[model samples]
Target: MSGFPLPPNATIGIVGGGQLGRMSAMAAARLGYRCHVLTPEADSPAGQVSAAVTLGGFTDPATLRRFAEAVDVISFEFENVSAEGLDLLASIRPVRPAPSVLRISQDRIDEKTFLNAAGVATAPWRSVETMAELEAAVAVLGLPSVLKTTRLGYDGKGQAMLRSAEDLAPAFERLQPKPLILEGFVDFAQEISVVIARGADGSMAAFDTVENRHANHILDLTLAPARIPGAADEMAQAIARRVAEALDLVGLLAVEMFLDAQGRVLANEIAPRPHNSGHWTIDACPASQFEMHVRAVAGLPLPPATRHADAVMKNLIGPEGMALWPAAVAEPGLIPHLYGKTEALPGRKMGHVTRLFPRGALPGDLGVEAALGPLLSPLLSPLGVIA
Candidate 1:
């Protein structure tokens, strides 16, 4: 965007058309800006709400060119787009966070190397190109490690665990696209994340560190102001700021981290867009994560990421969650948001509901379950085990 505080009518182009882009477009509408979406699906979650849609593959130069010409600025909802495709978009329009940032995040090897080089802590890892190397790396990282594809892995996909030597060959053979990364599993006390945004002028704002609980390897609940020690909260925020500055990031970034039993925070993954964990900010904060993302990409002054209330965001996944839509809507104090998807496929994220509490009044596990009522599942554990 050439102009500072991008004028109200400017159209912000988003590369992927998932729920992240959908919410981001909704937020941009509040600021008087229109959103243009690019995706292969004709009736995508984002295209449903956006002003315009350019349906095509992200890598096709012709489609990329067409999508680029339709908007003034470009950003992405996910990291699956090829780096070459983003480079093409950058030549036509300003791509916030830059293609270089995407390259670092697109590959696990690059992400881990960058994090360690940035003076941020992370789990020990080694690159594997062949079975021989996998065995040697496993010997060092030890049993009970994880093997993951270097690209296109999310929601517990593209990764496998090696509990015994018998598990190694089968996993290595099953995982696709040669070149994998083996990570030493962390015996952590809890899983947490921090979402932050940085403007073109170097100003930054970060949300409170929140604990994330998962069910079947998918995010099920996020507790705002993670019920951890005060020191751990400060540490998580510090790690996120360091990463934003290191990347010279010009958009939103979410740092997924693990708080080990030793009370240390280790970077697990980085997503350069709005994250699922930050959804609570929609009801808890003066400025939601989506608003901060649009503001940063539009060159607006960054505001303090402050929250007015505590909240718990629960993801509504698959058929079971969709089954509760009516009750969720009727439940008092339950804030519901459903994606415009016709089918609630298994493991598909259909929508989310949020429950808010008075500032600093977030309750413990039993209370959270009780409040969630119909939506609550006992899979949540306050002292989460990361193994």
Candidate 2:
């Protein structure tokens, strides 16, 4: 933490060469820093833009050591990288936000345990390791709840909704890797998130609370400065900043939350790197979340997380989303960012389009579609387009 603001030519090592890493690397380059990426995929999204790429398994000892030795500072773009591998890298070069922070965010059990203890509100949950425990947890949490793997789950992959008694045994037998967690179902009115960056000296910058709308559990669009009441927005941002401070984080962290029907904010998940929800900042804010991440890990002074324009960020997922690319590019006032991805695979995030509004001019649900022009189609469900 002492000698920093990494020299201009110094390289920053990033684990997981995904789209998040790609954008972070692009941001780093703008600030006169170099990036080296490590991933198993050949020609990974992040690697396409980075100065160097180490193609290897996340747990490979040789690759971890070699990557650590090459960079002045290290950070990760995603949380799926093995914590043990990160610990190995930390021994050779500084890993900002620390491996300890990553450990807390890696597993749902550990994450929830940390959040509740940190005074951050979260859904009622119980860990289940066996059929008896599952039954007991179900009895306590009740019939309608969510059963999920405590690790390696994202985009709605590792969860089952239990609505009836018949769902118990089948769901319990189907889920893999054992040791699950049961969360009491929350009647949420809206989904929102906040992205924040914390520096080594504990200085922090938090972006506005943004509303997230999803389709099939994949993010579809995000509204910066969520249309919720001011108090609810404040609560969401406060939870994010609190999580950053609690972890003593020195990098970007995005905290997703459920604003319940009663106007209470409950933390859902925490990602210690850039999040899909924060992509709007790339076009709306002077210092994007990616830039905040680079500055924090490189020991540079943090900039205000200020935005000049209100923005609606739309995700380009799968082949359907990719189809809109031509219109997205042709439309005036739409800022397009395609993640150098070759294939438009199903459910994959191919790229994104951002539409800016004058400050305080974000439109209502009905108006949002008109603002987006030809980007949205009738085939999409109303939830994805807010019809």
Candidate 3:
């Protein structure tokens, strides 16, 4: 083994046993590493696939120590894993991306501050701690702004739109008792994300930019090689790289950005693990994001993140997604991945499907729609699928 490599038979500890952990465990197994999953829930999606599982709360010191002792290194699939838990485990075993990364990502104020300090531009925003401060923020940012909790918000939860003065009190009332952030909304042309992986040796690889679409605040579809002009595509990747380097990141980082009307890219959020937008890489790229993450954390050499095919990734959310499973399996060129969640609750991500086409083919390519018609016609008719 090399000086940095975690030898083949070593165990990798994973925090947050969700679908991302499940997929990361699968990739680690392929590279000859065993995975031990830690989560509070029994029979977690990741636990089902891992070699060992410890069921306990993240903040429990005993649980953290026991888990740390069993694994050669630790990595988390979700950002919400307790920072205190990671700090305890780090004394026993290495945690890639580090606990500091978690602290920065878990709070909106810290995240925006870090981004701006790194010389990345973000939407105009103000920190609001009380109703009076919120009112003051509104006077400056004006109506049509977004009010979100400073921490623990995702997928549109903990967020409210303030479209008019009349909406302020109700919005404040709904999001009160917790710190808040009011952001002046950006009138953007499209949303895109760049998923990049950085190795322990500082080697980095970035996948093709992905265009994202959302429905009811949930990720709906992702099209690889987002149809922006070449310059804008390069700019997005550069911004992602800068953020990763600034964070001193040693694992995967996903930078979500908005392309404004003038074609400027503004950082919106950063996820310090394998991300939903990069799902297309599983079918279209030389190395999937999950595998790249494993390689980075295990000290294995990074692979070139190159796309060989045009791809479209669609989320299977709720009952609507579950209903398409039968057809999804039978469709040619479609790769279906179910998260193994027993309950298909509304807004929950049950699975995803990726369809690949020839390189250079756009969504509007003649045969793309015809090929995906059967599997997507029902769920995507209203929202429309981007190529």
Model 1 Cα displacement at 187 (Å)? 1.1
lDDT of 3: 0.87
lDDT of 2: 0.90
Taking the tens digit of each residue's C-alpha lDDT, what string does model 3 give over 14-64? 988999999999889998999999988897889999999999988889988
Q: Which ten residues in a row have the lowest lDDT in candidate 1?
A: 378-387
Residues 1-387, candidate 1, lDDT per residue (tens digit)? Answer: 456678889999998899999999999999999999999998999999999999998889999999999898998897777877888889999999889899999999999999999999999999999999999999999989999999999899999989999999999999989799999999989999999999998999999999998888899999998999889899999999999999999999999999999999999999999999999998889889999999998888878999999999999999988997998999999999998998899999999999999989999987887788877544634334211
* Model 2: pairs clashing at backbone N, Cα or C within 3 Å: none
Task: State which candidate, 1 or 2, has the greater lDDT.
Answer: 1
**Candidate 1: residue 186 lDDT (0-100):** 94
Candidate 2 local Cα displacement, residue 282, angstroms: 0.7
Off by over 4 Å in 3: 1-3, 365-370, 377-387
Provide TM-scores for the models.
0.97, 0.97, 0.95
Would you list the clashing residue pairs of candidate 3?
Answer: 363-387
